[model samples]
Target: MYDVDTRKRALALVAQGRSLNSVSKEMGISRHAITNWLSRLEPLPRTPPCVRCLESPGIPEDTAAYAYLLGLYLGDGYIISKPKQHYLMITCTASWPGLVDAAEEAMRKVLPWPSVNRLQRAGCVDVKSYTRHWVCLLPQHGPGKKHERPIALEPWQQAIVDAHPWEFIRGLIHSDGCRITNWTTRMVAGERKRYEYPRYLFSNKSDDIRKLFTDALDTVGVEWSTLARGSDPFNISVARKASVALMDAHVGPKY
Candidate 1:
C-alpha cells in the first residue's frame, strides 16, 4: 500500500494543475501508482483548498486524504477510449418532431466511409429510430469534433460548475434555453418558441458547444466574480465571449 503522506503530496500536485505524466516523472513514481492510490480513495465532499491552503502552513494528513480524493475527482481523470465510442448524442424531439431521423440519415450518407471507419475504430457508432422520430447516436470514442476549444470561464464560474454535479449542468442548459424562450415570448409574441423552432435550436452538449463551458473551467480551477447588478446572475456577453474563446482553443478554428 502507498503511504498516506505520499498520496497527500500527489493530490496537492494535481491541484496545482500538474499532469499525471509530469507528476509521475517529477516525483519518481509511476502513473499507475497514482491511479492505484486514487482508486482506493474516496472523493472529497467539501470545497477544495485554495492555492493559499496548499502553500500555507501545510495541510493535515487526515485532511490530505480527503483533499486527495477531492483532487482526483476534481482533477482531470483519464478518459479511456473504449475501442468502441462511448459518447451519446441526445436530441430533444419535443420541438423538432421529425428532425432527428433526418439528421441521422443525412449524417450516414454525408459522413465519409473513412470517417465512419475512424469512429468505429474509436468505438463510436450512430444510433437512430424513425417511428419515434427522435434518435440518439452513441459514438465510441466519438470524434473529438466537440472538444475543439480551450475553456475560458472565469475562476468563480468554473468553481460553481465544478462544485455542482453533471445533472446540474444538464439542468442548467435546459433551463437557460427555457429562459431564452420566456424572454423571446415576451419580446416577440408572433414568433414561435425558439426551443420548438427546429432550425435555430442546437444541442448545447456538443464538446464544442460551451453551455457548460464555464463549469468545465471551474473543474480546472478558474475563478469567476459575481456581478454587482443584473437580473441574470452571469453577464451574457462575457460568458458567450469566454465560451467562444474556449471553442477556438479546442477546435483549432472558430465557427
Candidate 2:
C-alpha cells in the first residue's frame, strides 16, 4: 500500500510522460497500482513525457511474449475505456480453454501487475485485465472497426514483429486463422482416388490487418495465397505441404 503523497507523486511522474515500467522500477511501486492511481485523476495532464528527460525507461521494445500477445490482440482483442476505468479485453470460444489459458499467461507476462478473470457468456470465454499500459503497447485503439479506420503498428510494435515473427504468426493463426482439411475424389488411372490435405485460412474484413497477417507469414518463410473476390472480405491461405507442416508445428488446435 502507498500513501497519498506516494500516489500523487506517481501520477505526477506518469503525467510527465514517464512510462509506468520505469516509474515502477525507480519508485518501487507496481504498474497496476500506478495505473489505477492515474485513472482517478480528475483532469489528466497533457504533457507527454520527453524521452530526453530519461526518467521513464518504458517497456521492453521486443519480447516474444509481447509480440505474440500483440498479434492475438490485433486479431481478436479490443480496448475498453470508461469514464472511471479502462481495460484490455480478449474473448475466445469457450471450447478453447487452452487458448484462453495461453492468452492469460501472455497478459501476466506483459503487464507489471496482471489480474485475469474468466467469465462465461453465450458460449464464449472472456479474458480481460485493467492496465493503462495496454494503450502504450497497442496504440491502434480507437473508435470504429479496424477496417473502417486505419491500422498500423507503432515503431516499437514493429520491432517486436521483426524480432519474433513466428510467435506472431502462431498467435494470429491460433486466434483468427485456422487449419482445415479439404477432401476431393478424382478418377486416376482406373479407379477414383480419395485425397485429403490441410490448409491454413485467415479471414479478416480489414485489408490492413490482412496485410499484417500475410507479412508475418512471409517473415517466417511460410507461403500464403489470397482468396477473395470483389467486394468480399480478405482472406489469406497456406496450402503447400511444406508450409502446412511448418504452421502445424507452431500452431495447433486450442483445447
Candidate 3:
C-alpha cells in the first residue's frame, strides 16, 4: 500500500498539470498505481437515501418530464423512507393548487403504477407519490436547505437539462416561482397615477438553488434581476416587459 504522503504527492503533482506517467516515473512508482490512486480519490458513490427507493424503479433518466420533475425536486421536493416503503413529496403552497396538480401529472407520467395524492397541511399542499425510484432519480437528496450544503447535478441530470432546459425551468419556476403584478405610482401630468405590470419571481432561501434558477433563466435567454428583501428569502425577478413576456411564453402561472 502507498503511504499517505506518497499518495498526496502524486495527487499534488497531477494538480500541477503533470502527466500520471511522468509523476510515476519521477516517484519510482508504477503508472497504474498513480491511476488507481486518482480513481480512489474521486467522490464516493452517491447511494440512494433509502434502500427501498431502488426496488421498483419508474422513470427513465432522459425524458423531458423526468428532467422537469428533477428541477421541481431540487426546488421543493423531499423524500421519506421507512423500512419496506418510500414516498416522494413535492411541497407547494396551498395557494398554488394548480401547480400541485401539475406536479402530480408529471409524476404519473413518469411512474404509471404508483398512485399520486395531494396532502393538505396548514398552508401547503404536498403532491405525494409512493415510489421506489425517487432516490435513484435524485441522488443529491439530503437533509437541510440545499444551499446550506453543497449541491451539484450528476452527469445524466446535466445532460437532460441541456436537452430540456425550458421544461426544467418550467418545473422550477412553477413550484417556487410566481408571476405577480407589480404596482407602482408616478406623477403623470403633475398628478399621481397608478400603473401595474407583471413579472416573474423565483424565491428561495438557498443561494445555491437561486443560482441554479438564474443559470437556467440565462440558458433560455430570459433577463432577470435578483434581490434580497431585508432578511427575507432571496429572489430573482424578470420585471422587464419584454423579458416577462418571453418567460410568459415558456413558464407562466400554473393555472
What TM-score goes with each of the models? 0.21, 0.76, 0.71
Best by lDDT: 2
Clashing pairs in 2: 17-49
Q: How many residue pairs clash in each candidate?
A: 27, 1, 1
Residues 1-255 of candidate 2: C-alpha lDDT, one tens digit per residue:
789888877776555445578578768999898888777756455444322233654555338888888878888999876443456878888888888898888887776453455667898888886655566667889998877989998776787788888888878776788788988899999899999988889888888888998888888889889887686858888999998889888876557
Q: How far off is residue 22 in model 3, in Å?
A: 60
Candidate 1 lDDT tens digits, 1-255:
567787877655544334577567767889898877667776323224432244453322323222222222111111222321211222323343233343343323322110111111122222221111010111112234333434233443334335543322223232222212112233367765443211111123333233453444355433333332444343222224454344324321101
Q: What lDDT tens digits, residue by residue, belong to model 3 across residues 58-118?
A: 3363378887898798888888755434678899888777887788888877665454667
Candidates ranked, most accurate by TM-score first:
2, 3, 1
Give the per-residue Cα lDDT of candidate 1 at 142: 28
- Clashing residue pairs in candidate 3 are 53-132
Where does candidate 2 have its weakest 10-residue lDDT segment? 45-54
